[model samples]
Target: MPLLNGDEEISGVLRKYRNIAVVGISDKPDRDSYRVASYLREHGYSIIPVNPTLKEWNGIRAYPSLSSIPGDLKVEVVDIFRKPEAVTEVVREGLQLKPRVFWMQEGVVNREAADLAVQNGVDVVMDRCMMKEHRRLLGGK
Candidate 1:
């Protein structure tokens, strides 16, 4: 199945899932990934920052990768901020984690990755920003 629009389903996912793994999250405040992660954290979602080069950001520990996060963080969403070509790898890794939703950021879409996620029984959202969807649907910033 192809990726779906983040409408009612996304809202439900966001409301139901509180812990999120932010792949490719940047330490720089100027980056959209950082801004979105911050927004999610501010809105009461627990964010696990995934960046290989960073150890910490905004007072939270940053894991080098998804597998590095210890003890079933119970992650519900995997928000990816990497390039389109890199999405397949992240999708493969996310499948191992078994998050409820796999989200590719705005302008990042890979049909193969989305299909792979769907095949693994994970809900997929491509070419969409999680922050925008949250604000539009959940009245969050």
Candidate 2:
């Protein structure tokens, strides 16, 4: 089943959460991950970078994995920028953080991963760009 919810629901999550963990975030400026994370950061959302290849992103410590994020750190959303096949592990590990939402960026979708997240009582959003949603739903930056 498709994991997308109504616009109102998505917007509600966006409005309520300020801390997001961007899994598979990249260091490249041109990458979607970088741009989206940057946009969210600029809009007052705390972006926690979760990329194994990077030691840090924009001066913030980049965790090698979701589980690598410090236990005390608060993550309200797990924004996935990984391939569909990689979503399972991210969702599994992200669950440990107890995030309120599991967001699969545009073009990234996995029914199994979405099901797993939904079954765990977490809101699941598939194939949507966080930057676009924030801009469209709540007005431009």
Candidate 3:
């Protein structure tokens, strides 16, 4: 079955996952990825920033790709901040990391990529704000 957008599922994901790989994260604090990553980290989630252009972001080591993340650090959720067209590549790379979920942030969705994730036994959440969902379902700021 494809990923469900039910509140229960969102809440479950938020409650269960602690490690998040934030793809396309930016150095700019004003960016959504930065804010979301910061919020998640502050809330106790281990945030691994993923961006090819930078070596670090928000003080966390930024990997050039999902495959580059050290083996010791397991990624539970792959939160994508990239455009829809770029999601497939990210999803393909994230699958190698074997994350529990492929999360396409607000305004980003690629049906093909989502289907690929589901086919690999990975849950997918597309076009949703991870931070907003966490705040609403997990009862945090």
Best of the candidates, lDDT: 2
lDDT of 3 by residue, 1-141 (tens): 458599999888899999999999999988999999899988999999999998998677899999999888999999999989999989998898889999999999799999999999999988999999989888888
Q: Please give the clash total of every predicted structure, in order.
A: 0, 0, 0
For model 2, residues 1-141, the per-residue Cα lDDT tens digits are 235579988898889999999999999999999999999999999999999899999999999999989989999999999999999989998999999899999999899999999889888999999999999999957
Local distance difference test values of all predictions, in order: 0.88, 0.92, 0.91
TM-score of each predicted structure versus truth: 0.95, 0.96, 0.97
Backbone clash total, candidate 1:
0
User: What is the Cα-based TM-score of model 2?
Assistant: 0.96
Q: Which is the winner by lDDT between candidate 2 and candidate 3?
A: 2
Q: Which ten residues in a row have the lowest lDDT in candidate 1?
A: 1-10
Tens-place lDDT per residue, model 1, 3-60, is 6673877788778889999999999999999999999999999999999999998889
Q: How far off is residue 112 in model 2, in Å?
A: 0.3
Q: Let me know the TM-score candidate 3 reaches against the reference structure.
A: 0.97
lDDT of 3 at 122: 96
RMSD of 1: 1.3
Query: In model 1, how large is the Cα lDDT of residue 2?
Result: 40
In model 2, what are the clashing residue pairs, if there are any? none
List CA RMSD, all candidates.
1.3, 1.6, 0.9
| Candidate 3 weakest lDDT stretch, 10 residues | 1-10
